[model samples]
Each structure stands twice: as C-alpha cells, then as structure tokens.
Target: MDPYTSFQVPTGDRPKYTGKKLVMLSPDASMKNIDAEASGAALRLAPSSAYKSHEEDYIKAFEEGDGIVFEKFRIAVINANHEEQIKSLLYARRSFQYEEPERYLYALDGPRSSNFGVLLWQMLCRLFGIKKDPPEIDPDPAPKDPLPESPPVFENTGEAYWGLHALDTLANSFTGKGVKLAVLDTGMYLAHPDFASRQMVTKSFIRGESVDDINGHGTHCAGIAVGGTRGESGIRYGTASEANLYVGKVLSNAGVGSDSGILAGMEWAVEEGCRVISMSLGASVEEDSNYSNIYNELAGMAMDMGTLIIGAAGNDSRRSQGRISAVNHPANCPNILAVGALDRRSEIADFSCGGLNPNGGLVDIAGPGVEVFSSWKTPQEYAILSGTSMATPFVAGVAAQLLEAFPEATAREVWDKLVDQARPLPLPVRDVGAGLVQSPK
Candidate 1:
C-alpha cells in the first residue's frame, strides 16, 4: 500500500527515503510468482506503475531456490522516516514473521539515520547471518603524481612505467591485433592526439552525458591497455597498441556510476565479442567478506560465453600507516581477475588493497602502478597517477596480447596462461597472488 495513503503522516514532515533501495528476499520467494504479489502490495499503497517501472531490473529467479540478488526497489513512505516505513511495511506484509516462509527480507541500503541503523543492526544480527558490523565506506583518494624529489626512471620507450615494457619483452610476438578490448570507466577524451589515429567504438551508459571523458581516469586506463606507441608529447605508453578499442563510459563525467549502468556495460562488452573487459571501479566491503553473488553469477555467465573480466583489487590500504583493507567488489568475484599494484622497485604499492577474503576475493596478479604515466583528458593530455585502478588495465592489455598470441585459446585457458607465466615476487600471496603479471611469449 502507498505509505502516505495507508498510514497517517505528521503534518509538514518530509520523507526520509527518496532514493533507491536494495532488497534481498528469502529463497522460497519465486521471482515468477513474486511479481504479482509485489505489485499487489504496491497497488495497495501506490500506483500500479510504481512496481512496473522497476520490474525489468529484477534478476532471474534461481531454480533450486528462488532467491534474487541485489534486486532494486523504489520505495517512498509519506512523512514517516525510512525505518518507520519499513517497519510498518513488514508488519503489514507479515513476511518477516517467524512463522512465515518469507523470513529473509532485508533492506541492504537505505537512508542513514538512527532508526535505520537500529533496523539494520537488528536485521543483520537476526536474519542476514553477518555478525560483523557493516564496513564504513571510504573511497580511495584521487591518485597524485609521486613526490618530486624521487622521480621514476623511464623505460627505453620513454614510458616511466615497467608494465608495458615488461609485456613488450615477454610477448613481442603479439600486439593484440584484431582483438576487442573494452575499458569500462569514466568517459574518454577521444580528441587527444595520442588516440587520433585509432578508430574506437564508443558508448556512454550515463544518461545526458557525452562519451568524452572529462575525469581522465578512463583515458588513462585506455592508454595503458591500447594507446599508441607515442603520444603527442612523444611518450610511449600503453600495451596492445594494435587491439580494437571499445570505450564504454560506465561512470559519468563526475566519476560516479550506478550498479545498473556498470552491469549494462558489462553485458554490452560481452555481446560485442570483447575478449577482455576491464573495470577500475569498486565499492568498499568488510574484511573476510564473501563475493557478491550477483556479480559472480554475471561474470561467470560471461566467462562461460568466452569473455574474461578484469578489475582492480582496489586502493584501500595504507601500508606505511599499517592500515590494511580487503579486496573490493566485482573484482572480489572469483570469475573476474583482481589485479593489485606494484611500485618501480617491485614492491606492492602502499595503497594497493590486499586479498583478506578467500574464495573470489584473492588478488590474482600485480602490475606497475606507482608513479605510472599515461594519456589523460585533453588540455593536460597526460597524467601520472598511482592506484590498483592503473594496474588493472595493464593486465587487461596483457590479456589482449595473450588472445592475439593464442587465437584459439578459451577464456579460461588465457587466464591460466597468465597465471602460469606470472613472475613470482617476494610478497605474500594475499598481497600479490600469482605475483607480477607476465605476457605470453
């Protein structure tokens, strides 16, 4: 029922939850039949179209158990706060009652308020089976150039990073020719002279935004993966220079993106026959966390269809201060390659995240990330940034190179070759899994 029409609201008060909500339901709730029940409930409180709009976003119901993962719901609650509204809804729906079969209804993300906190605490303790408190959200700060006093030495190619040079040495026979490589991130600055000769397939998932990358992160990553041998400034950056580029602007110009948009881009990349899909974005999660079932399933499906996904292990650690963080999501999914960052000295970068969680949460490889220079959005046209985000695309480029070398290799075979050829490092497996990523000879 519409919370406003179903319950009385205090005069002049505002609704606490106006944003989207994420919900997880019990295993018994069939997605096929649940729509009618959900719409019926919505009609009791709001217009029928309210549920109709969100219908397409639901994942397919499982066969063994009809559970849905990270299903989105747009909910409003008149003048009552989110917690109060949810409580009232649960009471009315009676789905959470001990006697009811639907005993696992949970609101994963909601308004941040005392009542909401209390509700989440109660739910996590009683239903979600997660004992630890939810981890705080801390986005890694934007990467900056290394200290001026200690500049990194450039390779023979004029690139100050070793990742591309390493790949060039190990896989000189393949240039990722004819392979489709997709980098999904902030939009690209295609007008940059470094990419002037390369024809690119581009699409912007962000509504009302152009494919031009204003943030520079996407262009930087693209440079690492498939940029030309020489930029307008004469620096040789990028790997897989001969590969076909598919630029999917999943994140907006402001460097923010929704889960739905990113997933859509993933689907598009796979459909376009991209052999490698690289993503340098993720959200924080607690240590020893389980992989995201949603992304695990999505990536696994893509892998079965012959596409390999690569993502950053995240840059949430501060080893100098001894604060360690876990691998972030999507990359935390086992089917995807989670890449960590290495410095010029072959040491793990101070801010590169580690593999604290097992099962889909392990770091698969390392790449040169510290003091790395690459192409950026125009006006500046080049940048030097440090993060696991930078390391991820280097591996993606190497994956493209692998595809070029072994044209008939399955996605799993390509993944195994990279792991098999990885140069062993001195760091712990959690810090640099199979060690530095190596190219196919």
Candidate 2:
C-alpha cells in the first residue's frame, strides 16, 4: 500500500505539517564560496569522503534496514558557497533562493527534493533571474492611493445561451454582492489596476512562503474571472466583476506542483466557505485506472457539498492519451465542470485536449481561452495567455454570478442552468459532454 494510504490520511484533508526543522552547518573545510544569488552564501572548505567506502561486512551488519535514524532529511548539494542560503531556506527565512539546488540542497536532502520542485521555486527563478536581496520595491507603498472609480455599467449581451455571448450576458446580470471565488494556481496579482476596486483573500500552500504569485498564470485568471468588470477593456469587464476573490497558491513558479499540494488547497477552499472554487489546472493520469479515483472522490464530495469545481481540459488535443481520455484530472471526476479551449477565431484550439472517455464522463464545457489578457502584478501591465486554464475560469466566474441570481441553488442547480443554456456541439456526445455552459435568462 502507498504510504499515504497507510497513513490513513484522507485525500480531502490538507497536508498539515509542522513548520519545524533542524539546522546544520558545513564544516570549516569546504568549497570556495561564491557571490550572492538569493540568500547570503557562506563559503568554506571540506575534506573529501567523510565516511570511508562501505564494505559488504558493514552492509550485512546493518541489514536490519532500520538502523540509523535521521532527525530530518532534506536535499542540499555540499559546496563551498551557498551553504548559508540552504540553511535559511530549510529554516524558512528566505522567500526564495537562486542556485544549483541539486548541487547543494539535493546533496543535503537527497534526490527526493530535487525533482519537479527544484524546477519551480529554484530553477525557474534562476531562468527568469533572481535578486541577490529581498525586493524592496516600494515597501509599504501608500495604501491611501485613492481607489480608482468603478467602471461603467455593463450593457446586456442580449441572451447568448452558450459560449462567449452567454458569458457576457451573465456579466450583465451580476448582483455585485461580492460572492467569493477561490482560484488555486500560482498566485494572484492583487495590485493590478483592473483589480484596485476589488477585494481579495489570499493564502499559500507552499509551506513557508506567503501568497506571492510567481508564474503570472493565477493572477491572469483572477482578472478575467471577476476583475474590474468595466472600462476601456470593453465588456472584458470580467465575467463576475462583483465577485470577491480568494487566491490559493498551489503551483510553483515553474508551473509545477504535487498532487498533495492541490489537495491541500481544496481542503482550505471548503473551509473558507467559498461559493465557487475555480481550478483552471489539471493532469492526465493513466486512463481506465483507479489510480485517479481518490481525486475524483474528493471533487465529487466538494460538489455534493454545494461547491462548484472548474478545471482545465489540458492543452493536449487528442482522442486518447495513453489508454486515458484526453480529459484532465479533477475535471474527469464527473462532479467537476471540465472546460476546454476555443481560440478567438472561434475554432477548437489545436492543442486543446478533447475526445471523451469511453466511460462517457468529461469535457462538460468549452470557452474562448486564447489571446485573453488580464491582470498582472503591476497596475499598468497584463499578460495574454491561452489554454483551458483560461477557459475554466470563464465558467467559474459566471457561476458566481449564477449564485447571485439563484442564492438558494445547489451545485447541481448551477450545472443545470448552464446545461440548460449551453450551445450543443456537432461532435459526438462523448467528445463534448453537455455542450458549452452558458448564462440562463
């Protein structure tokens, strides 16, 4: 059995870990120290091979398999420099570090920590470039900067039953009661100009860090979902401009994270009482397998409890991805609203994953996900990204609006309304579930 199962840990429970760790210092003899990257680097020289080569006699003596017990095990490469940075990271001092983590941190913790994660919090940061010191970018900028005026009143989009027009119609019917929609992704850019008038609740799942967006994906979704639903951006006036936002940082800077991290965010979302949880993220696990059922069960539970979970259909447009339908995970859970991508030109995105399950269970909706621009970290900037990542939010933000219209509605009711309004695709039923979700009159 998997250790996770053996631990009897419910998949719905967020991974609660004690924010504690032991510290160690490199001996005086180590490699030559180098200039700073993120945290301070302490250089030192070290002797080679602290332990002699293991012999068969010693191996046999310790064959019991439970001999030496480490108080803690974390990866770090032993080098003359970057020792202090590694120390600060383990103890949770620095927000990030830029270095060959595998060379130092991996050496200390072992290979386990150096995989996908190093590519995010460590590697991507290096690729994008890192600062030698903390960003003092206007520390404590005046909070009194007069909030910008709310944008113009949204005109009705007539009644588009599905796709973009329906989404636009939903925008016109919003109640502006400030319903909460939590998005689990990289993080949000709370300070963007399009969001100056909006309120946000932010949290982090990455252990020590605060909710700082690194990949820019999460923030972009935030802007499109319920951003400043008005202004020169046109009716780009976010789908639910009146809704509140909760950003849950699960993916790292490299756009990568573990299943445990995503699960942790889900648990937190339910606890926060968010009316809607939009997850424009997903994975393609092995098909026709129970390997992914644990996640599906969790999503189903969330749906049953009245929370709507929206997920991306992934970017791989294909019929079958290695015995599995192209539907993305959490999205495949039958309970979720799996959204696929459509380019602005109104065509299925070549890379938009599709083709339904042989079991008949996914791709419940489609939306315009390409060339869509939204919030960035700076008030004056934004990023135009495309993918089902953008499509899922289109439905979620509208669901928040639906909540305003049907406050007494359950998750199923919300789905019913969208289904009642969506435009049916000509493709096979399995290829595009119940058509595209849309706004109802």
Candidate 3:
C-alpha cells in the first residue's frame, strides 16, 4: 500500500524526477487494481508522462531479485517524501524507506538519477536510509582472463585486427582527420604508441581518478578506432588515426560505473568538441528523466554541429534481455543510432536486440560486431571479442569515412549515407534499421 500521488507534466518534455515516493502496487495486483487502490485513497492524479523511454535509465535503481519483475510501464504518482506522511494519509500503505543520497556520488546527469541514491530514500523514509548491500560479483569466472602479459595483436585470434582495415580506409580518405573521439569506458594506458601523436584529453568521473585501462575493454575499442599494429607501430591505420583522443574514466578498472558517471562522461565529451561518440554500455530505466533529454538534445546539438553518437545494443544474449527488453539507451534515441550485433558470417549476432521498440520506433542498424580483433592496453595482448560493443566502432569508423568522402556533410547526412550504402539483411529489417555499415563507402 505505498502512497502514490500525481502531478501535471508537460507533454513533450521528459520527466525530471522530483525526489518523490515511487512505489509499485502489490506483486499480485493488476494495473486496474492499482488504479482502484489509488482512487479509494482519494489521491489526485498527477500527469506522469515522458516522451522518452525510461527502460535503460532505471536499470541502476533496482537490481532484480529472483522473484521480482517491476519492469512494465505503469501509472505512477508522487506522494509525500516521508514515512510518517505516507502513513498518516494512505491506509495500509507499504512504505519504501526514505533516506538521503550518498554524499560521495558525482553524477554526469542529475535529472536522470534524482530518484535514486539518497533522493529516493528521503522521499520515502524521511531520513538518511541505510543502503541494502550489493550482490557480490565473483572473481574470475570467465573462460579466459589475461594473466602475465596479454597478446600484442589480438584477443581471440591474431586475425581480430582485420576490422582495422575499415578504420584505415576512412583515414586514407581523410574524414577522421583531427576529429576528437572520447572513449568513455575504462581508462586508457597513456603509453599506447598509436596515440603518441594524438592530443590526449582525459578526465575521471569516478572516484580515485585513474585513467588506466584496468579491465581492458576501453583499450580494445580504442585500438580498433586507432592503434599501432606491430609492424606499423610508427604509423598506425586507425579509424580516425589523426584525430584527437579524449579518454573519460567512467567505468572503473572492472568496467563498471554508476549512471551518473556515464552521463557526466557524455556531457564532457560534447564539451570537448568530439565529433564522434561511441558507447558499449547498457542498463535499464523505468522512468524517463531530464538527464536523458539533456543528453539527447546535447547529441542532437552535436549532430547539428557535426557529432555522431553510437551505442552498443548490449551483450545480454539471453532472449529476454534483462526485462523491459529492447536495445540500450542514448542509442535508442531517435537522433542517436542504436547498433545491434552480427558475426563474421553476416548473420544477426545472437546477442542482438531485434523488434520494434516498445516506445514506438525501430532499433537502428546492425554491424560486424562479433569476434572482432583490436588493441588492448595490457602491454602485450590484443583480443577477439563479441558484442554490439565490437560493432559500434565500425560504424564510427565508417562515419569518419563519410566525413572524408563528404567533408561538408552534416552528421545526419553522414548517417544517411551510411544507411544508404548498407548491405541489406535477409531478416529483421525493422530491428536492423538501415543496413550493415560497410567500410569507406
């Protein structure tokens, strides 16, 4: 019996969570029942509509338990911000403890994560709430982990770098020259030879600001975009090899970060004049937040000023994709292109998200996402891995190529050209927007 309240919301503007209690109906209750319960309490309805989907935005707020599935879109209202207030007004209301947000936190976008951290707790329990313990992630369960020297040229096979051909072709044409790319994952190793000539712009969004590739994912993506292979260590063929590089440390050495840190990274990338931004991360959101719109519009503005944004569909191969299942955020925005995965065979990657978006649109495009090889930060190793993560750079590299071919083209034009030149798929045309992006069209 969580007390629910509502407020009027403008139609086009996305929701900016205002530190109010947000509780779902009892597990067994239906939307109809929830509506009835609200009516019985005589709580006035507040308009709670956001133009953007909040699925990916809310992933950080609630980690699922074995028996819970609070992922559906539902009518929600804001009530008082205290347990006493909730109890006094609503009969038999189940209470979400109100507490304050963590003091150590720094957010990239405050509007998106306002309902989480302390704001969520304070709106319910009215005190600095004690956080529930996080589930422990075990150490070393992967089939492989780099130990005592990683590969110098590849991850799965030395052949992973073949994707390098795509980036080089774009550079050969000069589209990527001087463009700034911000890698917002794990930190980058300052000594990677390929970036020696690059203008390095770095920042730490997390605590203990170390801009090092602790988990190696950032290094891999960076290598594909622009890295010095063994023989050409002096002159690498990167997607935008001559482009400036900015490394934003959002994800930690473990490749994990909070929603705010990631959002902050986006803002920083835009502020740095990066022409292209790529993300290999994913999460869930139940409500749209101001943070989403701010970033979307920022990217839109970037597109207007010549920036291209690309996001990985995610590596969650499970058929159901965590719940509110669809592609990841930022990429799902109409203005941004969402990339799904595919393998060397050119088939839809098993982990790829396919279908019309629940929010009314098709997921964007597909690319060569599987088993791609690229440089890693570990002194000697490179890797061959799969994920739309691997696919996104291909698109970015192609965008760089578009810049070279059509130096005067807008970001939208470059994206349009990439789609126009895409190879048609035998399946899921709606799920895979244009076509698989090829190199240097």
Q: Pick the candidate with the highest lDDT.
A: 1
**Which runs in model 2 stand beyond 4 Å of their true positions?**
1-166, 229-237, 287-291, 318-325
Model 3: per-residue Cα lDDT at residue 113: 26
Tell me the lDDT of candidate 2: 0.53
Candidate 3, residue 417: the lDDT equals 81
Question: CA lDDT of 427 in candidate 2?
Answer: 35
Candidate 3 deviation (Cα RMSD) = 17.9
Tens digits of per-residue lDDT, candidate 2, 296-410, equal 5566677777787887776655311222146656576666777776543344544565544545346787766655656665544676566778777788877887898888898
- lDDT tens digits, residues 1-441, model 1? 111111222345323322322232333544334455444444222221222222122211211212222222221111112333334445655332111111100011111232244344546765967655334234234343342333232254554346666544434667789999999988689898877889898877565567898888899989988886554455557878889999987766656554545655676677789999989887666797677665666677777888999989877676655566888777888889899987665667777788888666889998877667788887998887778888888899889999998989888888898888887765577787777787677
- Ranking of models by TM-score: 1, 2, 3
Task: Work out the TM-score per prediction.
Answer: 0.69, 0.60, 0.59
Instruction: Estimate, for each residue in 1-441, the C-alpha lDDT of model 3 and write its tens digit.
Output: 110111222345333333434343332555345445445554433222211133222222222210111212121323333444344424565321222111111111112122243234334543545434222121113233222231112122243244544222523445466667777777677776555565688876545446777667777776656554544543243455555667877766655564445545665676677767777765532323211443355457668767788776554333322222355555656677777765543445555654435562235777666557666676665566666777776677667666766777878887788787775654455445665666564
Model number with the top TM-score? 1
Which has the better TM-score: candidate 1, or candidate 2?
1
Question: Candidate 3 regions off by >4 Å?
Answer: 1-160, 164-175, 231-237, 285-295, 319-325, 358-361
Poorest stretch of ten by lDDT in candidate 2? 101-110
